[model samples]
Target chain A: MTTSNLHAEIARAIQAAPLLSPIANQLLQVTARADHEMKEVIDLVKCDSLLTARLLRVVNSSAMGLVHQISSVDHAVSYLGERLVVGIAIAECTNEFLGKPLDGYEGESGQLWRHELFTAIASRAVARHARAPLPADLAFTAGLLHDIGKAILSEFLRGTSRELVADIVRGDTADYLTGEQERVGLDHAEVGFELARHWKLPEALAQVIRHHHHPETAEAELRPLIYAVHLGDILAMMGGQGTGSDSMKYHLRQEYAEHFTMSKDDLALLLLECSEEFRKVEASLASLKET
Target chain B: MSQMVLGIGDLGASNHPDAEIKTYALGSCIAVVLLDPQTRTVGMVHIALPESKINLVKAKEKPGYFADTGLPLLLQEMARHGCQPKGKGLIIKLAGGAAIMDHNDTFNIGKRNLLAIKKILWSYGLGPRSEDVGGTFSRTVSVSVRTGEVILSSPGRPNWKI
Candidate 1:
């Protein structure tokens, strides 16, 4: 197909896919505003029974390690706070889109979601360590959606292009994102940005999805946030969290490592916490499967 | 067959013939495998970095995170598992240690890891029987205790015996 035709086809595929649930989109908007009222969040969450049930289930679940049962959305918000609760709500809402395999990336079923979850958890840890301007939950959200483009781009890379990408990435000096652009006319980061725009997500979130692979190229104000996601991505890869065939093919930004002074003990502790969070997320997911 | 997975900064050994010990998603990290043909024993260590001087506490706590410390710990565990540490029955295979990010050789942790492993092994007068190291691919490595077979696989690439 011609380059324009391929681009059009990719755009159509992105539109056809289930981008994000209405509740998740609303949560995204509410979470963007620092002064968002708790009552507004409670009211919005109450409108979706699935979101409410999942939130209550999560807070009461051993993942939260809370002995008291959160019987209502109000109690959940009060106990877990608004940002974390919204992060989980987003996880629940977007599970369908995030929880699948990307053949182009060579991940098994649900591997992408696992990777995203790890990145989100690790991103929060990096943000706190770096003292980034963005809130922990926002960093988590940005990390979770950093690879949404791979999901969209995978469809367009079904045939010979997949091999082309794999070969180029495996070469001595080729970067994965550049290889993607060369073969498919656009990279996953850029495609992911377009998807975020299509879903009407906040501008900061969209910019994050675009520049995560190349944080230095991002706006100065968003550099710390982008670096958090970038470092989190590397940490996830190092830990082998939900990685696929293309696990280590991406660029590693050592500049981020230089900016932060992380001891081995600190890294070990952060990863331990991330592993705990991963197990909790897995437990909740298992329960979701049961129901 | 049962499979035992070794995470980063982890080392494990087993004598069960039905067991297959594996480590997955190895980028710059290295998986060092030691197999004993006579006892059907297998040991593997997934080491992340080169040396332990940078983090003494972590190296003390989890020696498997570095080549200098992890390799010795793996060997000790192998000997404890009733395997001949220096006999002909011992077969060593190494996989992973790839420079996934090719921007420059400055932060080539994979190359540094390989060099460390070589230096440490040379001190013991031992070396790997087979290796699939370097390049820019992430690898999953497995060793079959029953047959002492070491296999390596990566995304979009063929799985082959090392």
Candidate 2:
């Protein structure tokens, strides 16, 4: 197939992809703001009875281990915070898309969700070291949705892992993104950007989905958050939570040093912290998977 | 037969003859498999990083997360199960530590993890009997306690005994 035809197919796939839940969409909009209030998140959950229930359940779930049972939506959202609330809403609405098997990458069902969850948690941790003010929760949301394109592109990429790996080994392609472009004419990042646009996601998130692998290319103001998600993605893969064969196959832009003030020791600690949080979050959100 | 699976930054040992110990999706992480033929005991540690000094508190809570802390704790676990780390009957096998494609990457964790594990093992006068490490692919590894055979499998690759 020609490059234009492949891109056309990708556009169609993006159009057919599932849309985010109303609650999730609003949550993204609210959280994307630099000065969004916690009350806004609380009010959004209050509007959705099911989200309220899930939020309460997750906050009181054994994974959280609170001594007292809390039944109030406001209390629940406050305790779990906006990131976990957003994660719960997104996971609940997109389980099929997020948890599906990635045959293209030889990945099992739910692998991508786990990898994204880790990246979300890791991105939040990475945000702490940002040289400038960056909302940690926005970073979490970007990390969570960073690889959504992989779901749509996985089918198109079927049976290409070997050729891609071989190409990478022989230096015929620079990295997995290049290998992907060489084989399919569009990489997952670009595909994800299309999905983000289809979902009418926040501009910052669309930028991240498009340029996570090469954060330096993103607008200068967004680099810090983009770099957070970038390192968070790498940290997730390094922690062995990658989706599949393409694990750690991308180039790590050392320019992240300019965006964040992380040292080698800090990076190592971030991995440990992220893994620890990922365990608890995965357990807490297991109930969402069932729904 | 029972199967024990280790997640990243985890370790375990078993003495049951029919037991199998395994870990999945080992990208840059290293899995150290220890088997004792005399006692038919097997152990494995999925190490994610090379050192413990990065976070002493985490190392104390989950020593299996790093090569320095995890290897020692894994050996001690083996000793408790009657599998001596330095015993002649012990067979040590290493797998995983696959690097990313970038040669200039500062976080060359896979190579650093391999070097760290080897250095730690040398301190105990022990080394792997065999190793299947380094690549751009993730690996899933398993060891049989009864036969002391370690097998490795990865996506798009055939399963092989290491």
Question: Native-vs-model 2 lDDT?
Answer: 0.87
The reply for model 1, stretches above 4 Å from the true place, is: A37-43, A63-68, A72-75, A78-84, A160-162, A165-173, A254-276, B7-11, B48-77, B85-89, B99-126
Q: Each prediction's DockQ?
A: 0.36, 0.57
Residue B87 in candidate 1, Cα distance off native in Å: 8.6
TM-score of each: 0.84, 0.94
lDDT, candidate 2, A45-144, per-residue tens: 8999999888887888888999999989878887888998999999988999989999998889999999999999999999999888788999999999
User: Residue A95 deviation, candidate 1, in Å?
Assistant: 2.5
Score chain A of each prediction against the true chain A by TM-score and list the results. 0.89, 0.98
Error of 1 at A216 (Å): 2.8
Question: Which CAPRI quality tier does the interface of model 2 achieve?
Answer: medium
User: What is the fnat of candidate 1?
Assistant: 0.43
